[model samples]
Target: MSSLFTPLTLGSITIPNRIGMSALTRNRSTGTVPNEIMLKYYVQRAKGGAGLIGLNGPNVLGFGIKFRSKAGGKLPTLSMKLEVKFMLSFGIVSLTLIPVFLRPIIMLAAGVPVYAPSAIAAQGGRFRLLPGEPGYVTPTEIADPTPLIAQFKQAAINAKEAGFDGVEFHGANGYLVHQFLDSTSNHRTDQWGGSPENRARFALETLKELIAVWGPDVSLKLSPAGGYNDMGMPLQDTIDTFGYLLREVDNMGLSYVALVRFDEEDDGPRGTAHDVVETFRPFLTKTALFVNSSVTPAEGEELVKSGKAAGVFMGMNWLTHPDVARRIKEGKELDNAPDFKSFYGRGRC
Candidate 1:
């Protein structure tokens, strides 16, 4: 039997197969709400064979994420000029005042708790999540998660309410959570900044709350080698920050840690971090380590044997072959792989 097709248990969740789905951006949110298409898409994947699928935006709600989409679904090809325009008028200093302004509004609107790492607009854009195709939002301004955390918590509650298994925090994409972790993007001397440890403070605290509400079956997704929006940090810094975060969360008994791996080792930490996979590899001691990104079956098996990884994840390949797990198990040939170009929006052949 193909180990890839095997069933495994992480924390309290027992997935039927090892072929888990990684989060793919599918521009399908209202900046505040998920559209019907988004729900349908995930439900489709769940029915198809995905053990878990990470929700994009609400995963990381902070100022570091850049939502280039305007009031329409069109995302601006951002250059320094546009940001300068927005900053020169009001300046980013006042951007820091956003949370204060939004707090009262959220309290009045949702009557629930709210939280964020910084007072900036952020998003975790799923690739192909643009409009006019088959997704949700047409792209607009980035929404602050501070006021929306309660809503996301409610969304998680709703997911639970709807009978979904569990939720994974999307911290890897160049979203708010990632924005806070990478130092180059976080210069604030506040609690969320000062050092890598401090930057991870918000995520840690947020995890606590998530566990309080959702239990320990939650998972977390992260990529150490990304450069996005305002969040920037050297490889060494990311290693230090993520390493610390894994230890902290491990103690909390989080379910799984999905480390999005890359090929090149140049990411200061090692070109998109493959060279230094070892540094971050140790953090998975308490939980299962899910390494993904262009990984072949042989390499995955090696990692498991070498004690470098727990399981492997295939993102794009799983799109077309929703039954990939069953096929791999029975040794049947995989059907056509989905073209990356068609993975976005709602259209597919």
Candidate 2:
């Protein structure tokens, strides 16, 4: 049997298989609230045999910052009302029908006048909004991150009350948390910048708050080698920063950590490490590690079999093929072709 079909345990939760669904922002919500379409989408995936289903975006706390869609339209920020509705809807569905573990990827704001450890503008061109554009604004250096940390704590409390299996912090893909971790985006002189320890302070503090609410049920998503959102530091800096962060996370004894691998196809500024998982795997001695980014079932199986990853998280594959896990188990081919044109919209796929 393929290792991908084998069960894996993370802290107290046990997934039936090693093929988990990575969080993909489908934008199917009505305003900030998730509707029937979103519910059906997750239910189908769970019923199709995903061991774990990760929900993204609408579950994120926007901190009143408006997000822009791929077509340059303003996306609604998440409100407590919508958050509760989202959690209840998915939570109830998971409890009743699907035995799959449902984890929402909670993110900090990612929009206009972006908040960061320092006031740096993302590099422009090709999928990124240029300077002076409607959505482009240099980040506002956060004088105090206390209020923001409180928002994360409250978000965790809501998720726990709503009965989610766990919550994954969106500390990846150059969002606010990632911005703080990356030296290029975090050039502050305060206690939250300069050295790698100071840089990791924000993420650690926020994760501590979440842990206080949910204990080991909390997980984190990281992209140490991701160049998306114009984020990349020098090679050694990347190693030192994430290496230190991973050691700390391992000590916390969290459920798991998901790492996004470097994209060879991306034309943007690439991070130092080409194989992100391999580079940082040693630091994560105790916590279960999941790898994402264009990974295939065969490769995922290899990773699990080789003890490199506890599971594999698929994004596009899960989105395109609802029964992706079953197909992998049954040795069926996946629908590799994804409709890029219809990737994002406020409608059913």
Instruction: Report the lDDT tens digits of candidate 1 across residue range 1-349.
Output: 3455456776666665556666554546544244556545555555555544444442223211222212222111111211100000000111112232334322224432222344344332232323332321122222343443454455455444333355676666455567667665455676668787888875776677667766866777777766433333566777788889988888888777777765443123322443436767676677888887766656766776665766666776666665555555566665585665555334431
TM-score of each: 0.66, 0.82
Q: What shift in Å separates residue 65 of candidate 1 from its native position after superposition? A: 24
Alpha carbon lDDT at 141, candidate 1: 23
Candidate 2 residue lDDT tens string, 1-349: 3788877777666777888788776776644355557666776777678887776654455311222222121111121212211111111110011111112223323332335677666665322222232323465678898788898887677555444567788887767788888888888888889999999998899989988987877888888885876778887898999999999999997888999988765425566556888799999899999998889888998899999999888888887888898898888999669877777652222
How high is the CA lDDT of each candidate model?
A: 0.53, 0.69
